[model samples]
Target: MALPCAREVFTSIFKTGAVTKKFCGQLKQLGKVCNDAFVKKTLEDPIYKNLSESAIAKKSRKTWNTCASVIDISPSSSA
Candidate 1:
């Protein structure tokens, strides 16, 4: 879901030719782009996110770990 369109969002956010991290962060604060299903799952699911991680590869476990940390440390912004 959201992962599929992450590149698109990234490109859209960087269209101004400004690739700075701060610039990209600022653009993310702008309008809507895609459906919220996956985003909601990442934000609302259990901390372990077993069901969600079932779809991901074992080699990518670190990805989930980082996502969980973001959710734990910054629940308000994780969404």
Candidate 2:
């Protein structure tokens, strides 16, 4: 389940402003593809799906909390 080298990935999609939201959207699309592929590949693996409900909730909460932390609250913020 290893990925390609970072240099190879960057060479295929690199551009100026590649770290911006537009580029992020591209990455998110790729992420969805990768996630679906992973789930497809691992659906039969009970270990991957054995997490407790609370563990799943904690992970979901952590994701949103981290996203909230990244929000720019100041009017003068460059973000």
lDDT of 1 by residue, 49-70 (tens): 5444333222123333333343
Local distance difference test scores for all models? 0.33, 0.35
Model 2 accuracy (lDDT, Cα): 0.35
Q: Which candidate gets the maximum lDDT versus the true structure? A: 2
Clashing pairs in 2: none
Give one digit per residue, the lDDT tens place, for model 2 in 1-79. Answer: 2233323323222211123333333334445345334334443467556545454334333322332344421111210
What ranges in model 2 sit over 4 Å off? Answer: 1-48, 72-79
Shift in Å, residue 6, candidate 1: 5.8
Score residue 15 of candidate 2 by CA lDDT: 17
- Local error of candidate 1 at 17, Å? 20
